[model samples]
Target: MKSTSRQLALSLAAVTLLSAAPGAQAPASSRTRTHVQTLASDKFEGRLTGSSGEKLAADYLIAELKRMGAKPLPGQADFRMPFAFTAGSKDGGTTLKTMTANGMERTHEPGTAMALSFSDSAEVSGPVVFAGYGLVVPESQNFGYDSYAGLDVKDKVVVVLRYFPEDADQKTRAILARYADLRYKAQAARQRGARGMIVITGPRSPNAGELVPMSFDTAIAGSGVVAVSVKGGAWLIEGNGRSLDEVQKELDSGNPHVAGFAVPGVTATINAKVIRQQQTGHNVVAYLPASGSVSGVSKPWVAVGAHYDHLGRGTTGGSLAGKDEVNQIHHGADDNASGTATVLAIADALARQPRKRHLLIAFWSGEELGLLGSAAFVSTPPVALDQLSAYLNFDMVGRVSDNKLTVQATGTSAMWPKLLEQANVAAGFDLVLQEDPYQPTDVGSFNTASVACLTFFTGAHQEYHKPSDTADKINYEDLDRVGTFAAAIAKRLLDGDQVPQFTKVEQKTETGGRAGLRLFTGTIPDYASDVKGLLLGGVIGGGPAEQAGLAKGDVIVEIAGQSITNIYDYTYALELLKIGQPAKVVYLRGGQKQETTLTPAARK
Candidate 1:
C-alpha cells in the first residue's frame, strides 16, 4: 500500500505557534516539534560536524528522504554527499628548555612557564634577539615604529611584546587592534628569518601580569616556528643591564626612537608541538522532477535546503556561548534542528505535488564551520550553477514568536516579494523582507554564485548555539507554519510562468564581528578556489588590493615573507599588515609567479 500525503501529515500533528512576521495561519504537525526534540535530544551528542552524532543525523535525513520517495539530486547516489576539512589544531603536549653557549641548561614545565597551540614539534636553539614588539609596519616610515627596522633575527630566537603600540592615537589604536593576533606575531617572526620566538608582557603595558590562558588546544595546523611565553624571560633582558620598561615605553610611544638589538650571552631552546587531526562531514541531497519538466530553458531548477549539522560539543567555529562552555553539549534545537525538520516537512509536501521545474533539496553539514559543506557542493555542483532557478532556504525557523518573520533574498529577485506575499496569503504570515544576500548561511553560498535565493530566519535568541537550545525550547507550531509557507513559495517558483530574475547587489562587508581587524584588503577570497595559495575572485574597485594592481584570478602565494597556504594563513598574514603599509606580495597567473606591493588602506 502506498502512503498518501495525508497519511504523512497525520503521522505528526499537535502544535501551533505565532510567526514573528505578522499573522500566520498554517498547517499544524506534531512531527515538527517531535523532530526538533529528537534531533536536539542528548542522544544526538549535539550533532557536531564530523562526529558520530553528525553521522547519525545524516543517516536519519537520508532515511527520511528515501521514505518520501525523493530521488537523488541529478547525479547523486542515495541522499548523501561527503567532504573533508581541517577542523583547526589541537595541542598534544609541549616542552621548553633554555641553554647557554658554555653548556649551561635549564628545562621547565610545559604549558606553565610558557605554552603555545600551533607551534611546530621541533627543538631549536638560537641566540636571543630583542625584537621589541616584533612588529614590521614598513608603511609607517614617517611616524610608524617598525621593531624589525635594521634588526636581523635570521636563525635566532626573537623576543617580542604583546599587542600593538600602547600609546597610539585613538584612530591608530582602533586600526592596530585588528592585528593583535598571536599567531600573526609568530608568522611575522618567521618571515623575518627567526627560528623561534618568546613572548613577554611589557612592563608599561596593561595586563602585564601573566600570559593569557589557553583553555584547550586550537585546531589549526602549523609548522612555522617554535614559540612560547616565559616566566623567566625578564632575566634575559635584565642581564643585558638595559631596562625592559624603557624599551617598552619608547616602543609604545607609537613613534620610532629605538632599534631592536641582540640580547648578549643568552641562548634559548624551545620545544612546542600542536596536533592536527583531520575530520570529515557530509551533506544529504534529494531531487524532485518537474511535473512534465521544461526543456530548452536557461534556468530549470528550484531548490530548498538547510544545514543539518551543529557543533558537536561546541567547537571553536559558531559557538557564541563563551569559552567556559566549550565542552557543553550545544543542542542547537533552534540554531538549526528546527530548520532541518522544516525542510523534511516541506519536502514531504512537495513530494505529494510534483512541479514542472526540477527541485533539489539539500541538507548541508558544517555550516557552523565556515559554510564548508555548502561551499563544497556549490563548488562541485552536480549540475551547472546557471541551471538553477532559485534556492529557498529555511534556517532557525523554529522560534517564530509574535506575528513577525524575516525573509531574506528579497533583493535577490524582483519577483521575490510578490511571490512571498502570494504564498503567505494562505499561511497569512507578516513577512519582513531583507535585501542583502551576504549572510552567514548556506544561502550565502548560492548567492555568491549569482543564483537567486531566499533564506528564512525566525531570528536568534539567548539559546542560540548553546546547550539551552533544546527541543523543549522549540516553537513547533511556528516551525510547521514556516514549513508550509516555504513549501508554498517553492512550489510557486517551480510552477509559475514568470521566472524570478537574478539581480546583482553590492556585496556588503561584514563589520563589528571580526574583533581585531582594522584595515581591509578588499580582496574577495574564492572559497571554492582549490589552489596552493589564496585565490581572489573579485577585488573591490579602488580598494587597497585593486589599487595595488591585484585582480581577479590572481593566486596569492606569498605576502611579505610569509607563505600563504590557505585562507587561514592569509588571515593571519593580514593581521601582520598595517594601514598605509606597502608589503610585497607574490601571486601566480597561468603558472607564472609575479610580485606586487600593496599599500593597504584603513578599513572603511
Candidate 2:
C-alpha cells in the first residue's frame, strides 16, 4: 500500500508549521516519558554492550515497533538485530612474580604486569637476552640483523626494553605494518619462541592504584600476546655475579651489546588460570509506516538512530581521579536514554500522522565497543544502502546548556542547511551549527555510505558517560523541542523534491580528522564530553587509527608523554608530535593502564 505523494507532502507541511509555531508548551506524551524512563531505568544497567540489559532494551523497542504496524527488514521477521562481542578480563591475575640476577624475587603489579591473554603455565628459565628495542626494521635504519639476529630466545625469557627508536619522529612507514614499535615488539617476543617478554617500565615508579577502568581503543585491546612489566634493578643470577639492572644501565648509558650476565641454571615458573564467558546483545529497530499507507505514492525513508550503550559497571567511577570503584551502574541518561526517548516520541508522532516516507526508529548496541552493531548494519544493511535516503541521529540531546543545541553535519547534505534554517526560523530556537560531519555519533556510518546524515545534540554536560547522567537531570521541555525539531526535519526530507547529496571532500583523507592527524577511518569523535579523556567518536576503515587498532569509544588519556585532560589537550599533544612519527601512547582500558606505540597519519 502506497500513500499519495501530494497528500503526504501537504500533511508534512502542516506538521512542520504546527511544530514551528509555538504559543505554549505542551506536556510530553506518556509514551515518550515511559520510554525514557524504562530504557534508562536501573533495570537496563546503563544499556551496556554485550549484556542482558541491552537485550531487554532491544525487546522493548521491537515490541513498540510491532505495535506501530511496521514491517520487518527483508531477511529478518523481527525488529531485533543481533550481534556478538568478546570482552576480555580486567585483571590478568592477582599474583605476578619477577626475578633478577642477584637472587632477588619481586612481585609484579597487576595493571603494570601485562600477560598473554591465551597462554599455558610454564616454569622453564634461561639466561636473559637483550634485544635492541625488540624491533626488526630493515627499510628505514637497515638494522643489519633481524630482531632476533644471532640471539636465541627459544623457550627462554626475552628481556626487552621499552619505547621505540627515540628518533622515529623523522620517518614515515618506517616500521612493519603488524610488527612495529611496542606492539610489534611484544608480538615479536611471543613469536620468537620466547616463554615470556619482560618489558622494562620507564624508570622505577610506584604502582598507581587510584586509576579508573575506562574503555580502551581497539589497538591495544586486540593484541593476543601475553606479557608483563618489570622494574629496572640489579639481580643475582645462578652462579653469575653480574646484575640485570647493571646490564640495563650499561645498555642505556652507551653499551651496544649485553656485557654482563649469561648464567645457565636459573629457572622460573608461571601459572595462569582464566575463565572467559560469552556475552550477547541486540540492536533495537522499529518503524512507523506512512499514515496513508493504503494510497499509492513513492515516499523516501528517514531513519532516527542513537546508540544506547555506556561504560557500564567498570573499575572507574564517573571521575577518573577517584579510587577504583566497581559495580556502579553508569546510567547513561544523557549519553543516550535522552536520545532514545526522543526517537520513541518521533515514532509516535509519525505513526499518527499521514506522512510521505516510512520512518525507521533504531537504537544501536555495541556503540561503546567500537560501533560494532552499526558497522555490521552498514556492512550488511537490512534495506539496500541506496534506499536509505537520510539518517537523523541523536546522541546526547537532553541537556541544554545555556540553551545551546548543536546540529552537526549540517553540511553533509545539500538540503540539511536549508531545512535547519527553516526549523530555526519557525521554532524560535537558535541552533548552534558546526560543520563537522565526522563527529562522535552514529551518523558517520550513514555519512560514510554516501547517504545524507545529520546529528541533533545538546552540548555536553558534567554527567556525560557517568552514573550521574540520570533521568532527573534531563531537561524534558528542551528535549520536547529537540524532538519536535528532529521530526520536522524528517518531515521536510520526506516531502521535499530535492534529495540530499553527498558532498565529498577534495581529499578523502581529510574528511574525518582526529588529533590533527589525517585519518581515513570514518569514525567520529565525541567532543560532547571531556571526562572520558578526549575520545574519537568513530574509527574509519583502513585508516591510520584503524591500522593502529584504535577503536571507537576508547578514551585517549595521553599522547606521547602528555596528559590528555580534555580534547584540547589531546589536540595539542598531537600537534607537538608530527605525522608518521611513532610515539608511545598510554591509555586506560577496563581500569588497567596499558601502553601502545602508534604512527599517526594525515587526516582522511
Candidate 3:
C-alpha cells in the first residue's frame, strides 16, 4: 500500500511539471526562487544587521543548512558567530557660550548652535580667530587657495564660513567643493593647532543662518577636535572693526588674496559630546566535511560565502530610495538576497558530493557597513589562516542581462583563468573578468588576508540599494545557472589535488570613486580595527605605501604632520598631500614606532 501511494504521488508530480507554462523553472530554479522570495519578503524587515529581522534570517539560514546535512564549523557549538560594531552616533547635550572683552556674555540657544556628529566630545575655551571660508585646495591642483595662510590660530578657536565661495566660476567652485566637507575643515583647524572650530553659514549662501543638522556618522571615534555649527555669529567679528556681511562679500570675490584676522578679546567656550551606539551582529558559519576523510591526510579548507544584511526601512544610511518611498522597506532582492540564495543552492549541491577538502559556507552580516562581519572573521578565525585555500563570493547574480556575468578578483590567483574557462563550458556565460581585488565588498576582507578570492556579480541596475529592488524582478533561471557554475568551481577547489596559489595584484588608481579627491596614497584602512590610530589592512602593490615600507597590520598615527586618529582624519589628510610630493608618515608596527616618507601619486 505504501509503494502504491508513492507511485501515485510521483505520477501527480510528473503531471504537475508537464502542465506548467512554457519557460517555467525546473526544480532547482524553483528552489532558488523560493529562497529569494522568502528572504526578501517584507517580514524579514530588509534583514538589517543586529535587528530582529536579521535574527529571523539567521534562524532560517541555520535551518536550511541543517536540512542540507551541513554542521557547524569545526570546534563550534552552533552556526552563529557574533561580532560587535558601532551602529550609529548621536549628540549628548552639546552647548556653546561666548564672552567679549567688555565682559558681555551670551549663551547660545540649542537651535542656534549645534555640534557636528563627528566632533570630539570635550570642552574647550580659547580666543577666537576669523578664518575666511576655511578652504584648502591640494597643492597638486595649483589652485593656490588657503584660508589659514598667514593666520596665527594656535591655541585659539576659529570662526570660518561654511561652503565655498559663492561668486567663483564653475571650475573654481568645483575644486573648492571637493574640500568643502565640514570634517575636512575641522581637520584643517586641528592641524593648525587650533583648539576648536566654529562654522557659520554666510547670509548670502542658501539656507542662511541655519544650523547644520547632526547627520549620521559611522566613525567609531571622534574627529580629533571640537567642532560646532552656528546659525549666526556676527558678534564674533563685532570687535574686529568689520561686519560679517562686508567680510563675506570681500571673500566671495574668489581673488584668493582675502586674509583672516584675529577677533580681539573674543573667547568662546564649546562643549560637545558625540555618543556612538554599538551593537552585536552575527555571521552564520557552517561546514561540510570531506566526503570520506582519511585519519592521517592533511586537508585544506575552501569557502563560499555571501552577505545577507541590507538597508532597513531606507534609514541608517546606504539607501537610494526615492522621496516617495521614504521610510519604506528596502527589499534587497538583487543587492544580496539573490546572492544568499545562490550560496545556499551551491551548499546543497556540494553537500551531495565532495571528495578531498572541507567546505566552509558563511553568510556574513554588516557588509553594507564597511564589510564589518568578514573583517571580524578574518581577524579571528576558527581555523588556521594558512589552511584556507580559496574563497568564492557571490554578491548580486540574479539579473543576468544577455547572459553576461562579471567575475571580479581574478588576478588574486594565476590559476583562475583556466579554471573559469573549464567551468564555463557547460554554463556558457559571457564572463567579464576583472583583475583588481580591491573591491568594495566582503571579497576585500579575504583578499587583504592573502586568500585567493573570486566575486561573482551580475550587472547593476536602477533598482540597486533602493526599495524597488524586489524579488519579483529576479531572473531565477539565470540565477540557478550562476549557482551551478559556482558549484562547479567549488568542486574543483574541494576535490582537486593542487590548490590555487595566492597572488598579489597591484591596484590601479582611477580618477572617479574617491569622493573627488585627487591624491592617491594606495593605503587600505581596516575599518574594523579598534586602535586609536588608523589601522592598515594592506597596501597596494608597487604603490606609494608599499614603496614607503608600509605593510599590513601597521597603525598610521600621523601623515604629513597631521595627527591621524581615525579614518575621517586620514581622509582629510589626503587633501593636504600633493602629487609627486614626499610627506612624512609615522606608524606603529608590532608596537614599535617607525617613520617613512611617501610620495603621493595622482589618480588616473
Candidate whose TM-score is highest: 3
| Cα TM-score per model | 0.77, 0.64, 0.89
Q: What root-mean-square deviation over C-alphas does model 1 reach?
A: 7.0
Per-residue alpha-carbon lDDT of candidate 2 for residues 156-273, written as tens digits (9 for 90 to 100):
6665555433333333224332234354565556556776655553332123122222233232232334444433422323235555444444444322243323345443434332
Tens digit per residue, CA lDDT, model 3, 1-604? 1243354345436534643654453477767876787678787889999999899889979977886789998899999999999876777777889999889998876667788877888999999998899987767677899999999999999999899889988988988988888888888888899999998998888877778888765566667889988878877776868788888898998778899999889899998867777799999999999877635444479999999999889688889888999998888999899999999999988877856788999999999888989988998989777888899999988999999999999999999999999999998999999988888889998998999999999988999999889888999999999999999999998888778899998888731125676678888777666577888888888889999999989999999988898887888777678889899999999999999999999876
Residue 534's C-alpha lDDT in candidate 1?
81
lDDT of 1 by residue, 302-326 (tens): 8889998898787565676766766
Lowest summed-lDDT stretch of 10 residues in model 1? 12-21
Q: Is candidate 1 or candidate 2 better by lDDT?
A: 1
Query: Which regions of candidate 3 are displaced past 4 Å?
Result: 1-26, 109-112, 240-242, 291-299, 322-324, 510-513, 528-530
lDDT of each: 0.75, 0.59, 0.86
